[model samples]
Target chain A: MSLSEFELIQRYFAEASTDASVALGIGDDCAVLSVPTGQQLAVSIDSLVQGTHFLEGTPADLLASRLFGSALSDLAAMGATPAWLTLALTLPEPDEDWLQLFSSRLAQLCNEYHVSLVGGDTTKGPLTLSAQVHGFLPRDHRLTRAGAKVGDLICVSGCLGDSRGGLDGLLNGFENHTEAGYLLERFYAPTPRIELGKILLGKANSCIDISDGLLSDLSHILKASGGLGARLQLEAVPISSQLIATFGEESARQWALTGGEDFELCFTLPPNYLALLSQLPVPVAVIGKVTDRADIELFLRGEPCQIQGSGYDHFQRKDD
Target chain B: MSLSEFELIQRYFAEASTDASVALGIGDDCAVLSVPTGQQLAVSIDSLVQGTHFLEGTPADLLASRLFGSALSDLAAMGATPAWLTLALTLPEPDEDWLQLFSSRLAQLCNEYHVSLVGGDTTKGPLTLSAQVHGFLPRDHRLTRAGAKVGDLICVSGCLGDSRGGLDGLLNGFENHTEAGYLLERFYAPTPRIELGKILLGKANSCIDISDGLLSDLSHILKASGGLGARLQLEAVPISSQLIATFGEESARQWALTGGEDFELCFTLPPNYLALLSQLPVPVAVIGKVTDRADIELFLRGEPCQIQGSGYDHFQRKDD
Candidate 1:
């Protein structure tokens, strides 16, 4: 256990300050920030646990990136430009290397997005992290998950579920040159689609990032819009070629449909804005459409099929 | 320990409706918010741990209120209007009654402040809570701790050390109500001085909320404003008359000097605004003045006395 909380914060949580927009950073009671004028701020918070969120010996930098990426996914969903973040970390003990890796990666992410580390809390307990992020959205341009019309096209950025496949490999020590390992890396270091989010602010109707499986996460958009459901085209759901080569079709399908932690944007757009959506800096592929049916479903070549068991139900489970 | 993470959030966290200004509330990857035009947002986060910050078996509603008040004090210090908040709660199990009490008090706080509970995380683990709050500030006036200048009058709202006295009574179970019991209640249900904060926003040059002991927290103002110190009148440090009567002058004085957890506002006003400060709504008593000496001193009838230790240092004796 850490000897003291103050030392723990200094050692494990304080990131190197370079171009931090924070008027006052951590070490104070609260972090103070100056937001740019004419911009509305988007805010989100997420917590990740050790045994549950990651494997026992996961790389610290990778874990840091993945957690931040998960929270950043919310900004992307809102089409908000990244701004600043605060962290609350509870740990079992102080580890020097872990702190170094975590801080370095945090600094890297902050620099990449021009965001700053504003404030945080560090405590000694079970290892867990909760991050609260702030971002800027233009007036009347904040993307939401509630505006998807029935005819709007459903789109997803990047492939989904390779992170789960990677975890399977990590647990079973399965190795494949195909995309599972690559997808795992993708899962671990998802590049937050900041630019794409900015472009879709007003262009997209309803938006969400797929951290859970597609059906589970996309259901949020459907429910938010007061829409009945969406019909996801299984074949059209993007899967990395590497994932296909390694996990094979059946396993890849399982991962894509049910496995989660991809941190990809799963959003809806008006059909008329297809050109605009296609022109986004990141690849955005339409794979489904909102429908009047209340029952969310998956269609494989126009035939109804079960959606890999509600796509990661916390109350339900698959026996490995 | 718990069944699943989603169930935890759904059961303990998911509100039927944020039903407030939450453009998009919980259940999405991130919560989307709308910032009213022309108003800047103030943000702060604080995490509390069991056995470190509070004793086990603390009243659930009191815990929730205390934690919320801690964050509110930050907003109060910033002279910001309350807006939205997110909570990250980790626990060993789902105690139904505890959740009921906690959520109830949380709802009360939200409704009282006109703030919405936007997003949060609930997980099974050792007990910890991180509350992140966002508030709005007026265009060019943010009362920062760094704005105090020479000849500024230092002032505080509400009495000090009551909470510390209360916590001591609770922890050691010193049931004699002669005075400690009131102190304990004061600590448990601290008033965040929101009204006082707004009243002083324009009149005060520098400001901070005293969560740590007054002497230590006030030092933040001094340090922020170039290490300019002040001489505080021992008599002027507010203490409840009942406390002095019950515990006698010596113990109450000790508590006033080094005990903490009082979420009161401490601010500085230039002499030019001194008359204006005196006319403010709350009793904003000028207890001291900024001085050239770089070390804080306490005066009891013109006799200089040593303050034994830093206020609220958890690991060391305050008088050591």
Candidate 2:
């Protein structure tokens, strides 16, 4: 018998949930979950369409990773502990092989993050996946983009521009190169810094995930923090060896500034907490400092530098 | 300036939440909400794609209502009180007029249901709307499809055939007929029986929302309930006057049996509680009884009748 929607859910999607907080999982009109007392539930939704978000040749496993990872990154940005997620998947047709790979990878990711796939929907259409991720944080402890102060030290976890390099490599037919492979992996499976986000909860004054390039995403924090700006030391912005070796320093620096989908945490902390950051498990770099001015400034080798373009704008054509 | 995704959200979606449980609303990486103590959160997701779930010329306002209304019906089926919702909308282009009408209607519906639009994502792609709705119910009081007993009485709220009649009218160029208007409205914007669901909690043995026709959706309840079946009295199944007026008795009866998108609650309750159903605000019809046999039986004029099909199956071709 061909797999019906109900059968698809029962066989592939309705795995037993490991989360104690999930009172009920798949196979119901709604999944029931428990939120512990003194905690607030954090909810975020993201949709990724075939050509708009990922290329046509992307693997099913990688597509699953990219979609869920990007969605979970929002929970990371909020400093919430990932708990449960629901996926609404639309497809041109049902392919059992593709479904198996997608569901397995998604389940693996959920297992690693201790999140349960509580509920979702499946429909026939052009390829699109929308995930709604839920997490929880102690009341009043969430890190918001509006909390940055003028004197805060701007910090970022891990190197930036790697995912952009990966995307460029894929577009330019450079995926066979060893360096390109690493970049492609970064682009296809960007890791959400959930642990770092939880650690930065009270210490970081403001935070955002670098999805739309550092400049654009940081601008969100700046705008939300009452018109505060930032001053960046170009030399301090971390770039991966693969990116620099493939495209050289100048191009790598440009990608680091404007290439989107890094999925790294960009946060601001008081100068007093700089020493505490040393105790963090992940390598963090102080890229800049928050400024009272209302626009970002860049300095390369102590000389003011002009940067072209901010970040990806969905509605604006590239040539515009 | 062109309408950027951020600008579009700010202009239309960033509304103040009426729900006090919403600790944080739009314009953040995540929306934070509080679930009342002693309650479990109920989560469900639904997606509507162009040409599949809806027609090309469907009004934006009606589309919004249908999408959210159907999603909310899942919560109603679970007997959960609606609390928060997130919408992920993918559009071909930014149409300000369309967006405004869609958002306003969605907001109005949320207001009527006291649900908060907490967070969402807006992307550019072929038109698709996915909504994830969250609700809450006391931990032990949830109504599930698995709870039906063989001896329980089967009941349904509101008329069943109207939406199907409406769909037929839309497809057959009969939409302009005055008699078809009510059916069209029913198809375009079927109201979720939330109040009735809430009233049925603790009283109903099992419940499910009618979306994919009476038989197909009830089959879900039966399958979930484990080896249970139902005996539906064809004569007693509720049919609207509009449906009978548009199409004669036989066609109307068939539509009532197999046409989908009703968004009405079909529930089973113990025989003793049948009288209590009279207190419900909406019309409740006793259509049948739960059966010990493992397959649904239909009787017309107390004579066994053969039915051709049950309901819409996403993967199955119409001809099959």
Top model by TM-score, which number? 2
lDDT of 1 by residue, B97-175 (tens): 7777887787777778877777777765667888998887766567888888878888887777778777767766554
On a 0 to 100 scale, what is the lDDT of residue B203 in model 1? 79
For model 2, residues A1-320, the per-residue Cα lDDT tens digits are: 11255345446544548568988888788889999889999988998888788877678899999998899999999999999988898888877778888888888888788888888788888899899999999988899999999989999988999998887887776634769878988998989999999999998999999888899999999999999999999899999998888877877898898888989999999999989788887799999999999999999989999888887666563452
lDDT of 2 at A185: 84
lDDT (CA) for every model shown? 0.74, 0.85
Query: Which ranges in model 1 have alpha carbons more than 4 Å from their true place?
Result: A1-38, A56-59, A93-97, A175-183, A273-278, A301-303, A313-320, B1-27, B94-96, B178-181, B245-248, B271-286, B314-320
> For each predicted model, how many residue pairs clash, with residues at least 3 apart or on different chains?
5, 0
Candidate 1 Cα lDDT to native: 0.74
- Looking at model 2 chain A, report the run of 10 residues with the lowest lDDT sum: A1-10
Q: How far is candidate 2 from the true structure (C-alpha RMSD, Å)?
A: 2.2
lDDT of 2 by residue, B1-320 (tens): 01255345445544547568988888888888999988989999999989887888688999998998899999999999998888889888888888888888887888788888888888878899999989999987888989889889999889988887887887776634768768878988889889998999888989999888899888888888998999988888989877787787787888788887899999999999978878998999998999989899999899999777888766664453
TM-scores for every candidate against the unseen true structure: 0.87, 0.97
